[model samples]
Structures are given as C-alpha cells and as structure tokens.
Target: MTVFLRLSAAAVTAVASCQAVGALAQEVEPSDRATTDRLEEIVVTAARRPTTFQDADVSVTVLSRIQLEQARIRDIRQLDGVVPNVQFNESGQLGSTFISIRGIESNPFIVNRAAVYIDGIPFRELSNAVLNQVESIEVLRGPQATLYGANSESGLIVINTRAPTDHAVYEGRFTTTGFQGGTSAMIDGFAAGPLSETVSGSLAFKASTSDSFLRNIQPGRPAGEIRENFLQGRLRWKPSDALTINATAYVLDTNAPGVFDQEYLPLDVDLYNRTYAETYNGGRTIGQFTYVNDAPKKTEELETVAGLSATYQLAYGTLDAAVSYRKLSTDARGLDVELTALPTSAGQDYKVKTFWNGELRFASPADRPFNYIVGVSHYRQDDRRFLATFVGPGELDDFVPAPVQLAEARDWGAFFSANWTPTALPALTISGGLRYDRAHRSADQTAGSLDLGPAGIFVYRDASLSGDFDAVLPRASALYRVSSQFSLYANAAKGYVPGGFNLTAAQADLADQVLRYDSETLWSREAGFKWRSSNGRFRLAGAAFYIRADHWQEIQVATDEEGRLISSDYIGTDASIDSKGFEIEATAEPIDRLTLTANLGYTDARYRNLQLDADTNVSGERVKLVPEYDGYLAARYQASNGLYVRAEAALTGEESLESRGEAIQPATQTIGLQLGYEGPRWSARLFVDNLTNVRRSSGLAFRNFAFGNDGNWYAPIARSRQVGFELGVRL
Candidate 1:
C-alpha cells in the first residue's frame, strides 16, 4: 500500500510539473512557434506486420535509434527502469540472465517466460540479451503466443540491427570508465558501403577489458577480471525491384578469471557485519565488495549466430522466409558448497551444438479494409552438459563427475491472424488470431557415482525420458478511434510454454513423478488508451492488465519419501499465480528543444495454489523477484549550439527473494546525469551512473542446510558508482 501511494504521488507531481511548463510555453510569442518541433511518428513491426504506434491494438514501448544513443543503453539490464513493469536479474555470469515482466518471473533452470528476438534469430535460454549497432527496440506486453508461439507468456522484445546502406558510411567510438575499484576501456567501430549494383555489406565490432570492482581480501588471491569481444556482419542483395535478401552473422566471446560470479553473505545485517569483521576483513565491517576464497575460479564462453531472410512482393500479398542457426558453449570452475576459504570446488561444461529454426509467412496489403497474415515455423535444439564437484586439497583437479546429460527438442507451429474494419462502423477495428503448436522433447543420462570422504558414496541413476505436448492459443483485440489524435484498445490472449522431461532427477522410485512436468499456460486481458495533442508536442499512453497462470513450472529440490536429500534437482508443475498491474508512460516537449519523459508501473502478483513441499502451502504469498512498483523520470535539454544536458531517476519497490517471503529487498532509487556535445563530424559525452553509490543485491539464492548453509544467502552485488567519458567520430 505504501509503495502504491508513493508511486501515485510521484505521478501527480510529474503531471503538475509538465502542466506548468506547458502553461509557461503558452505565453511565448506567436513567431516563436516556428522553432518548435512535432513529435516523430513511430512505426512498429511487433505484430508480424507494420503498424503505427497509435493504430496497434496492443501495449508496447518503442525506443528509436536516437533515444538509444541519448540514454546510453548498450545492454539489456540497462532497460529495467526505462521499460515499465520489466526487470532484469543479473547473476554476473555471462550465460545467466533472468527476467521478470508484469510479475511473471523466469529463473536460470527454466526456459524464459519472455521471448527475445535479435534480427531474425530467437533466444529462449537464460542468456545475456546484448544490444549492438541496433536501430530500434520494441517491447510488447502480454501473451504473444498467437504470433510468436510458446515461451512468450509474459511478453516479447524485438531488436532490429542497422541494415546495410546503399551509400558508404563509417563510425568509430572510444570510451573509458572509472568505478570504485577499477577502470575499463572499450572500442567500437562500424563500416558499411555498396559492394556492387545489387549488393551491400556492413560490419560492426566491439572490444573491452575491465578489472573487477569487487576486491579479494584473501592473501595472494586475485579479484575477478573480464575481457570481451563482439563482431557482427551483414549483407543485403536487391536483385530486382520486387525481391530482397539479407544475411547476418554475429559472434561473442567472454573470459573471466579469479572469482566466481556469486558470493555468500549473512542475511541478518548484524550477523553480516560481525562475520565480515571477524572472518574476512580483519575487524572491519566494510566488506560488501570484498570476499575470501581459496579455490581457483575461471569462466569462458563463446556464442555464434547466423541467419538468412528473404522478402518478395507478390500479386496476392508479400511473402517472407527466414532461417537461423545458433551455438553456445561454456566452461566454468568455481567454489562448490562453501563460501569461505575451504578446499571445495565445482566445474561446469556445457554445449548447445545444434540450434536451428525457420519460418515462412505471407501478409495481405495493409490498405485493404480487411487484411490477414498466415505463417508457419519450426525449431530444433540439441544440448549436452557435464558437471563435477571436488573436495580436499586437490580442489578442482581431482573431482567426482555427475551424470552426462543429453537433451533434444523439436517444435512446429502454424498461425493465422486477420483484421476487419467494416464500412458500417468505420471508426472501429477488430482483430483475432489463433495458432496450433506441437512439441516433442527427449533426454538421456549416463550413470555416474560420487565419493565423499567419510560421507559415503552417492550413485546417480541412469534414465531415459520423453514427452510430447501440444497447445492451441488464441487472441483477440478491438480498437476504437475516438478522434484523429486519440484511441482506445482492449485485448485478450493466451500463451504457453511447452512441457519437458527432467534429466537430472536421480531417484529411481520417484522417476515417474519427477521426470516429466506439464506445460505452463497463461491468459491475459488488458485495456489501454493512447492520446496526443494537436501539434504532437505531447503524448500519453496507459494500460491496465490482469493475468492468470496455470501449471507454472519451477525448479525444486529432489527428496526421498522420508524427506531426505537426493542427488539432483527436478522441475515441478504444482503452482498457479494471479497477477494484476497498470502502467503509464508520457512524453512531452513543453518547450522547444527540451524533452521530458515519465513512466510508472504497479503490480500485485501472488501465488494462488502452490505447495513447496508436503509441509508447506503458500496460497497467498507474494511472487518472488517481482517488485511492487517501478518507475523512471527523465529530462533532457538540447541547446541550439550543440550542447545538451540530461538528468534521470529510477525507482524500484520492495521485492521478495524467496517463495515463503523470508528474504526481502527494500525499495531503492537511483539517479544519473549526462553532459554532451553533438556536432556534424564529432560527438563527446561525460556521464555518471548510480550517482548515490547505492549498494544492493541484484539477485539471491538460498543454500541447502546440508550443504554448508551457515544461516546465510548467496547473491551478486549490484555495481557501484561509475563515471565515464565517450568520444565518437563519423566519416
């Protein structure tokens, strides 16, 4: 309740401020109006078709190239506050990134509830959604199953990279950043030009190196350090006026050394202070960015993606076809169960060797009174993983390997959607879509054993499992044009995630119960309005939504009948959730060359029917990782002499870190400032992030009591204050 009140007050204050600015602008001379600029019209392709922002009957947020540059948003985590009701949980690892949208949460063990698309390739894993040389980003909220199929229950994010240009262009940038404990440097370059009369090509690359902000307190131990490189290339061919083809490829490599991505700390503040003072920091309590570990740690990852797409103009409609391939491999070694300087370590090696997908679609002319689209898609993936644990002085060199797990999946879907604008009711438009999806998954495990001194030997059971799941999703929407500058829309949709087998469950007797989990489904309903002034100097959009989820999948501990710990974890489907939320976004140009933007979101999400175990029933507890409220407010002023200043604030409400609400994260507010100069041939900027030096955990996990819990929790601390300068040149 308090969070909601604070959000309401902030909203009111922002509105009043904007109104005062508008009133002040009204007193300007009539001749000064010529200097004012109208808001630019934005066109989006989130619905598998092109539509203006006001004409689309869905809740969405669009960021253009200029906005991305001004905000200095280079990655996905930076979008948390800019987009309403969205949060990114960073674990410090390159491959693990969990996302929460509108109270629907995703973790490292399960598939993402929200889907992400870069270029024409899809990503369903919990991986970093990096942005590079991107032209625009579109965030569409609600269930998008009718068009995107499964794994889009919460929402969808679409990223379109800058395409090859017909004329020659070149750009380069260099950056240096200083933080609490270290400094980093980065370089980026892009080049594009015409190769021939019918072909054009482009290349973009970035490289960076940074020292870890977190210091190691242990003697002779080093802090975590990182090095990264990225490259992308594109080719476009226009053989004829009616046909076009595009091919793109990208690669990312990351390496980290010294410390693991996470650390353990006592949950109680007093205990934390005492423990750090006595054990790690030599009687000092200032150890939030310091840790002690004896075992060697390192992580290496490589990912590659390639795609091809073609479009042809036809007599009946436009035809489009696309295909993509992706591969990700990683090897990491770090501490196992103990957070202190104990001789315990763990290792993980995984490879996604084969991931391929393809799609074909056709759409009718948009000018027609009645238009439609039809499409079909297929996806396949094969993965293999290996894990090991080590104890004693040997650490990671001498270890016990777990079962070798191999998994494969295949999916197929067909969908259709249409819009109707009857002549009798020209002011209203109705649209509907439906899709049928089928998925098959299988897994295999090789037997293995682990030997722990004095604790007895543990055996992993050999298993083979398979499952088939199917779903029919549907969606509908209606939009009413109240006036040329105002509209109202309502939408209802169903989304789902396909079922799969759990290859890691090791208990023989509980195989049937733990080996397979059912698919998860959600139904969402939303209503929203969009409005703009006559001169387009002001724009406002708002939406209210409700969602119900069934068969929600979760990663749970595997235990025997007597409640004894088992060898592995399993996926379970024994919970449901109810979520309701509302979001508001406004953009105003109160005066010439000055822009103001504000967005606020509130969500009330709770478990409906959930059983963590035989002894616990959490029916009304708040959902984990979902904040009660979040918002962003920013102001930017650009002078005619090429100088600009921007100031922004981000607000996040409290959140529960555990299912039973044992761990809570308090609300926080952060501020940022930027000063820059833009010229025809050169640009420069100086910026400060997290100006208040706020220290907090971005994510948290509980340790099992049997595996050295020590009444503490594990988490990754958020970044500290950072100041940076960037210089760029265009040729």
Candidate 2:
C-alpha cells in the first residue's frame, strides 16, 4: 500500500530524469556479447561490477563447479582447509553443521556476523545453495558495504547457481561412492526447452543419501544416515529483444535420519578421541521463489526475499524500488542433546518463524567518466520460539506440565548509501554509506498461550528502545591501468554488523547487573593487481589485505552459566583484532593439450587489543581455529584420444582450539589426493580425503563430560583419514 505508492512515485520521477539526461549525453558503444563464459568473468559483484580480480583491490577466491568436482568437494562440511582463511565449527550434531569463513563469522539465523548471497539476491542462509547444483562459489574478503549491504562486515561467500539458457538442453548424472567410514550415492537431472514461441522453462533436481562417518562410539549404536533432496525450476518468456520475464520456484529438503553423537575419551590417552557412536533423530524444510521482468530500459524483480530491490536505469544513474517479506520455522526432537543438568524435554519442539527485510539501490552506469550509486533500505522481522521444561531431574522423564516460555520480537531498520567516481578522475573512486536500526522484542511465560503480566512486557518493550544504534561508513580506491593487461589498485573500507538483544530478558530486580555493548565492526584496507595474456592462454591475479575488528561478538560466559538458549556479548573493547592475508593465483595453458592452475593464500589473524571485563586485559589472544596458510595446486591433461585427467592437492595449516578454557584440539594438517579419468562416454574417480587421517576435530572441540571417567568429547569427530572411489558410464 503506502510502500507501493512511494515506490511508483519515485520510479516515475526517475524515468523523467533519465529521459532528460540522455538528451544531452555523449555517444558510447554498447558492450559486445562476451565470448568467454560469463562464469569466468572477473566478478566485481563483490565491489558492484566487473573488475578484474586484482584491479578491483580485493582478495578473493573463485571456485567453479568443474574445479570443485575435480577436487572431490562433496559436502559443504568438506570445504575445510580446501582454501585458506576457511575454518569450520559445527554444533547440534552432523545435521546442523556450521562453517566459518575465516574466524568470527556470523550465524545468519542467529546474529549479524557475516553476509551470504545467491545470484544478486542477498540470502542469509548459506545451507540453501544445493552443493551439487552450484555453478560456482566466490569468496570475497573484507568489508563489502560499498555495493553489498548489511552484515558484510567480515566477508561474504556468494554462490552462483546454474541459470536458464537460450538453447534447448537435457542432462543428468548419477554417482555412487564408498567412503572408508561411510556410503554415499546420488542422482541429479536437469532439462531446458521451449514451450512456445515466446517461452522456455528449465527444471532441475538432485537427490542423495550418505551413511554416518563415525563408527561404534556407543556400544551397539547403529550408523545415522543423512539425506538431501532438491527441486528448482524457472520459466522465462521473451516477447521481444528488449523484454524478458522470468518466474522461479524451488523446494529444498534436508533430513538427517538420526543424530551423530560424540564419545568421551580421556585426555592423556593416545588415539583417545574416536567415537562412531550414533544418537537421536530429526529434520527441517524451507522453500521460496520469485518473479522478475527484465527490460532493456529497466528490470523489475519481485521476490519473497529477505529483502527486495527494483531499479530502473537512468541517464545519470539508476533509480531503485524495493520491499521484503520472510518466515522461518525449525523443529528438532529426540533425547538428550548434551550432558547437562537440563535435558531437551521429549516431544519438545524448537522453532522460529516470521522475519523479513527490504532495501533499494540506485547507481549510475560505470561506462561514463563519473559514476555514482545511492539507495535506502528497511528490515522487519518476527521471531517466536518455545522450549520445554520440567520440574527437576527426577520428574524430567515424565515431561513438564506445560510450555516453559515463549520469545518473540519485531525489528525495523533504515539505511542509505552513495558511491562517487569524479568525472575528471577516471582511475579513482570513492564510496560512503550510513544506516539506522530500531528493534523491539517481547517475551512471555505462558500460563496457557497468553500469560505474562504487564510489567514483564514493559521491560521487554522499553529495553529495545533503550538501545538504538547508527553507523557511518566511508571508502575510497583507485585503479591505475599500468597496461592493457595489467593494473594497480588500493582501497580502504568500513563495514559493520548490527547489534542484537540478549536471548532472554532479565528482570529489573537484577538491575545494575545489566550488561550492554553493541558488537564490533570490521575495517579493511587492500591492494592488488590483475593480468591476462592476449591469447587467453595465461592469466594471473594477486591481492594483499588487512582487517581490524573492534568489539568482536561472542557468547556471554556469565549468561551461559545462567541457563539461556543464547547470550549476547562483545569482547576486547580496549583492543582491536587484526587479520592480515594475501592470495595469488595463476592459470597457464602452455600448449593446447595441457593446462595448469594453482592458488595460494596466507592469513594471520590474532587479537591485538582485548579487554576482558575491564580488569582481565588479555591482549594478543590468538583467535582459535583460523589457519595461517592454505592452498591448492591442480593440473588437467587432455589427449587427442578423447580422454582427460586431473590431479590436485590441498594444504591446511593447524591451529590451537580450546573450549571452557581447556585445550581440546591441537593444530593439525590434512591433505587430499584425487585421481580422475574421463573419456567420451565414461568417467571414474578415486579420492583420498584426510589421506593422512590427521586427527583434527571435525565439529565442536571440547572435553567429553559424558565419557566414562576418561575425558574426550570429540573422539571420532573426523575420520582417521579415508578414501572414496567412484565410477560412471554414460548410456
């Protein structure tokens, strides 16, 4: 309603402005249809447009599907150490796996730590990019607010999925592999064709199942199995060269039949951490889609997105209109989740649904000597959660008499930004942006669905207004074209993640003990270069960057001890955290039959200034889990005999990880080896992941509180290095 009126008015004003500007502009050539694959295009998407990997002044890694498959990257969890600056952490068993890009990454569903996107869509959930369905994955380092928005303070991991094509097509693939400690099988298919003179549609689906990787940690325990299924389709209608309309729909489902548990082992014993014990069972499902009209003059996209944006190209710049809507829900069940005085009550369910965000963007075409971007955005969300509780340990088995409590929230935000490139300075660009957010949360202990006295509600509502926040970020960079194939550039930018409330509200009776500190922000500076040969046979890129983070977010230790689902806390206010790194990659085809590629990266992340609760000043604290070095080397050999072979190796450095102030997992490195053979109609592969079985914890690392006398929480978190073999023959 009112939102629509505002958008339409702005749009009309933009059209008039564009028409007027074009009347006085200089002539320029329309870009030629790029001959190289678009996927190969150096994505400036990280910055906003197509800038060479190096020319744009950002450190990044671009992994295409071909490379991923060749490296035997099967699961999202398998990405550990595959690239530098990537460390993983998972809790709540195998099914709820969570990975961190570098350290201090955010949980999209729980906090504002990092930002994730799909296509041009800013999607918060990283798990939705069906692994097998991805066309490419791009990792962007450092602050990205000049182009992308929100929580892009630390970094961003973008997935570009396969898209609709211009020609008709049919394709399918099936694979089966035996892992040392597990079994996995998969089938995927896709088709695209014309339905009429003006329309075409594409359909894609993937299905897979894998047995648990651990053995018998618990006596008589059986292996838990995990399954994934997905179906996504798109229909596009092109009525004219200038007009295209597309509608999309998708369904993704992940069901882990049972829980994968940890076995406790004593700390002093060698090979002490090893448990293939299986436990629990549950699942979850999420679905969504969108409709878009892309015209030569303007593109209109309507999405059920976390947020939305609609922009019309204008002569001076583009004018954007936007909106957003969202809803999320989760349900997990079974027995005990962890060793605690409290057990996740049986038949008890955990859930969160109803949250949405919106934003708009406008930018001038970069072709002109001077370019700029301006936009505003908003967000609103509703989260409702409930858990079960019992009287005490003795009566716990019988279940509690009723629902323990309910948590709910309603939040709002607004933001604006602009990027300017002076007309006379063709080699320089400057950007600036700002944001303001307001959030409101309410909670209740239901006596029966509607209960919670007035005072309880007041405290919740008043506390929200008590903590409003605002931020301002500015950035600048320049690219000096050293040659047609080379360029030098440097940039400095600021990015921040919004603050959040504590999980459960504390009563005024506990006043003076209330703690409040908005989380940290990341500021980064980077420099790099780009080069390519005229023959397209050789390419190279490199970049160096440093990031400083202040007030890093963390789980509040005191809150945890007080018994809450989650606590919010910021650490090291007196000291800033710093992560410095460099990445370089080269691809050269010396001859028609041979191609070589390699990428190397190094990142050093540590705490420089850490102030723990005013008195405990722990400066120089090393951020746990982030490795200092990682890289991959690969080669592809093709023969006139119609066969191709690829060999690759990846290296990951070790790090010291601890929990509850006790050293748990030590630094270790795991290497991977892959051998593949491909021909006209057949292919086969043999992969040895964790080939060294380097004993590193795969999930959360901590001492086992439940282990029998001996103490190891993560015994078989990771396999003792394993191997997998697969073969396929086309009909």
Candidate 3:
C-alpha cells in the first residue's frame, strides 16, 4: 500500500506539472478585480456556531450535492471506502447496516455508538431515501458529547436538505443500471417555489427497484431482490421580520430479499456418518448431516418522520426551538439456518419503534468579544418486538416462541459552550463546553412454548428490569493563527456510551447478571494544521490523534473445542484498547480545466491487558472491523465543448472479522470511470463502477463444523462491473 501511494503521488505531480505549463501558455492574466476575489468560504455549524471551516479547531469532512451526484452515490452503502477511516456496509443478514468509524463500531439494529441527524432531527436508522434528498453531508470524526450527549462517543453525521426558494425551481432525473445477472431502474424529481410573498414550500420523491443477484439452483424460488419508494415535503413561513417557522415530513417504504446461504461438500465426509438425522418438512431430511435447505427469506420495513422548528430574534442574540417525531415498523421471515435439527423451521419476527425529541436553544451574537450558546434537549424512545420459530412437524414436535420483549428509554441533557479571544492576544482563541445527561431504561420480556398436540401451551419465564444512569461530559480547545492562510489547533474531549438492559435475559436465577451492561468511557486528544494557498486554488488539511478507551462493552460467543455452540454473553471487558492515527486530505487544480483530489487515513488500534479470565489472556490483538489503512484518489477533466471525464480508485486494508482474530478478510481495491455532457438545462452521463470486478467478503457467518455451511457468506456481487446511464432535465 505504501508503494502504491508513492507511485500515485509521483504520477500526479508529473502530469499536473506538464499540464500546468501548457495551459499557462494559452491563458490570459487575471484582471485587477478578478485577482481580489477568493474561493467561496465553507461555513459549518460543528460547535453549535456558524463559522468558516478554516477557522474551526476540529476535523470535519464536507461533501456537497454536486460531489455526491458526480460520484453516482445512490445510498449510504456507497460511502464505504470513500472517506477516511470510515467503513459502512449495508449488506448483512436480516437487512441491517454495520457502521464503524475510527475503530468504534455500531450495530444498526441494536445499541448505537454514533449519532445521525437530518435537519436537526435524530435518525435512529439510515433510511434508503436519505442520501438522494440531502443537499450536503458533514462527517465529524470525534466525540461530540458536549452537544449530542450519549450514543455519540465515536462521532456524528449531519445532513441538511435543500429548502424552498423565493423563485420557482424544479428538476427531474432518470437512470438505468445493468449488470451480469440483474438490472435496476430509478426515477427522482424535486420542486421548490414560493406560493405567497411570505410562504414557500418544497417537495421531492424517488422510486426505484432492482432484480436479485443470486440465482437459486433449485426451481420455483424467487431471486433475492430490492424495492424502495420515498417522499419528502417542507414548508417555511416568515410572516414577520424577526420570526420564522418551518415544517418538514418524510416517509420511506422498502422491501428486500435477505441473505442467500449456500452449502458445499465438507473436506471430511466421514464425520457426517456419526451425526444424527431425521425426516421433516413433509418427507425432506433435516439435520447437520443432510443437504442444505433452499427456503426463501424476506424483509419489509416502513418509516416516517415529522418535525417543526421555529426561530425568533432576541434583543441580544437568537432563540430557536424544535420538536420531532419518528416511527419505524419492520416485518421479517426467514429460514433458521443455525438450527441443524429443523432446517425448514420458519423464523418470523415483528418489530415497532417510536421516538420523540425536542430542544430549545439560545445563542449570543457572533461578533461579541465573548460569545456563548446554551441548550436543553429531551428524548423518548420505545421498542416492541415478537419472535417465533415453527418446527413444521419436525422431531421437536412443537412451536417455540423465544420471548416477547418491550424496551423503553428516556433521556434529557443540558449543555453550555463559550468562545473567547482576549484583547491582548487577538490572534489566539479558546473554547470550552460542558454537558450533563440523565437517562432511565427499562425492559419487560415473556417466554413461552406451544405443543402441537393436545398437550396445550406452556409458559416458562417472565421478568422485568429497570436501571438509571447519569454522566457529565466536557471539551476544550485552542487555536493559533500563524498567518492568514495557515493555523494550528489542539483539542481534548470526553465521551461515553450509555448503559442498557438486555432483552435476551430469560433465566430467573441469572437475570441480574444478564439484564444489565455498564456504560463505557473514551478520552481523546488531537492536534492538526490547516493550510490554503493565496490563490485559493489549492487546499490541504492534516491531523494526528490518540484515544484511550476503557471498559469497552462487547458481546462474545463461546464454543466447545469441537466448534459446537456453548453460549453468547454480553459483558464489559476489564481490558482497554488504545488507538492512534493520522489523516491527510488535499485538493488542487494545478491546471485549467482539470481538478485533482486525494485523501489518506491510517489507524493502529489494539487491545492491551485483555484478560477475560485467569486462564484466558488475549492481549495485543487487533480490534475487529478496523483496517490498518484506507485511501482514495480521483481526477476529473472538462472540455470547452461541454464534455467531461473522470476516473477514481479506492483501496481497503486487510482486517480480522472476529474479536479473537479467528477469521481474516483480505484486502481489496476497485476503480471507477465516468463520461458526461452538460448543458444549460439538461445533462447526461454514462458510468462504470467496480471496473476490476473485485469480490471481497462483505459479511460472514462461519464456524468450524463438518457441515459445508462454514465458508458460506454474503456479498453485494450485483454491483460488480455495473454499467449505468443517467439523464436529468431542469425546468
């Protein structure tokens, strides 16, 4: 990987230098007025204050709408290796997304380690429609506890949507993507304009569907597929000069066919002879010693969100308030592959979640010598789930209902942040923030089983548990300007992940141990430098960071020496993991009609003194889901005839898949190309992604067993060698 980076740097320098000389010969000198103009300043609200990116003492990455469209990114999954130190995989069992940032991972379906927000409303899950309707995305890679509170120990993601305008605006787009075994079609449109002098509204919608990638060798089984539809609307009113009100609503509907587990022949066939087997599912044999089951699996989900925000001018500053409500429902049914006794047992589950959030804030004037912001927020969330497994005339001869669980959580927090630049030190600035959060969590679960015969129903276990937690988080930072175009900054921050009650605790005797997991703490120190050229055509940023984390909560699965399942436990490790890394990002247009961009990230995260028990000491092991290095490089060229071409390449480093370093996933690289033509009102593009046809494992479920299912895994093979065409028109 180092060699690749060196070669790429040399090639880019040589080509850009040659092009610069040739273009300079054909270009004219800038006029006096043109020379005074500079690049448009990038504004951000990372610290709850509006400021230029170059003036802030934090690390952040911003992607504009134009950049997203140029990359042909349709969903959050496409952002996998594009950014530094971020890994996102939307392909997994049961249609769940896996997110990891800076060596901290979060489960999309369960507890969260990071926070995501759209238009100031917290999003518990990433819907399929979010990426297509947002105007910009900000990735802040650090503890955001001062403002975001719990669940933001790793980082935060902010999304802003395009609002209504005073003048009428509208656009429509159509696209088609084709691959070896499947094809997809998408249609999207948006319109925004004013209905009255003081009133404006905007609307956007998208509809898309795609065929499946895996082809079932057996007949009469539908291929795994996907379908989604989304709609969003917004209204803004400014009846007075000092007051403004806004309303937003969005809805998403999605259907997806889940993992396709295939079976193969084991290396040692003799082990199967000793295994027991039985006939089930209407004369079909079911057991670890038998052939695989080819049953269909599917998932369907619906999500809706509504929010309202109001802002009013105060005598000395500004006041803002907002409230939002969100609801999500999912229904899934699939074959139970892990249960070797009943290969055809149907596993069905239903889940429903609701969330409510509100906030009130006030801020002093930005130009004041001492500026400050204070805010209070409240949140309430409830979840209900039911699951059942039907044996369907197997040896078990009964339907097992694993338990119905109800979980509820409520939290509130208050924060205060201040910034100051003393009169004696005009070129130096300091900032500090403090926050306090209190939370209450509870869970209720019931377990049961039903006999198919006249034996009747049996209830085994029922229990309830509750807990409360509170914490105080703080942050401080300083920045010094060496010159107008360069600055140095350093910061120290603290973050934590909230404790929770586990719903899987069923045994009455062990309920106390299994029902509660403690919160974890993380402390980080970072320093970096920012630089920009006087011409405003070149920009560079870099950072070095070290993090110390303790009491990390992890779910570990145990098995016997023969690889047979024993138990899965959720516990807080007594050990610690230290993480250190550096990042570099640069953008330059050394020659006219050409632009170049590159970013590199490196991380070294490992566990120290990790002793699960007196007999087990697995220290110095690499953290799961964290790669050593990742990077990307791209270049684009535009001609005077409205034609453009761009090429990009991205790489991911090798990493272990499990905590004990049992399974290893190899490194992989891919390239992309695009050709497009633009006009005043219309544009068209043809693109090819994954030109190298790389097939790395995206998700894995493996164990060393005689059955051929050990090596079976799931990957988005449909995206390989993809050919796509897009057309757009504005009105």
Better of 2 and 3 by lDDT: 3
Q: Which of 2 and 3 is ahead in TM-score?
A: 3
Instruction: Write candidate 3's Cα lDDT for 161-272 as tens digits.
Output: 8787776666667777776667777777767878899999988887767664443222334555667778999999999999999999988888876423222222222332
lDDT of 2 by residue, 399-504 (tens): 3333333444333444444445566865555545454534444434433321112111112212332345556665666667677777777778787665544433
TM-score of 3: 0.85
- How high is the lDDT of residue 12 in model 2? 34
Of 1 and 2, the candidate ahead on TM-score is 1
Better of 1 and 2 by lDDT: 1
Write one digit per residue (lDDT tens) for candidate 1, span 311-427.
999987899999999998876666434455544444444454568999999999888889999999999999988766665655445655677789999999999999999989988
Report the Cα lDDT for residue 131, model 3: 56
Ordered from best to worst lDDT, the candidate numbers read 1, 3, 2
- Error of model 1, residue 458, in angstroms: 5.7
Model 1: lDDT equals 0.77
Q: Give all TM-scores, in the order shown.
A: 0.91, 0.74, 0.85
Best by lDDT: 1
Residue 32 lDDT in candidate 2: 13
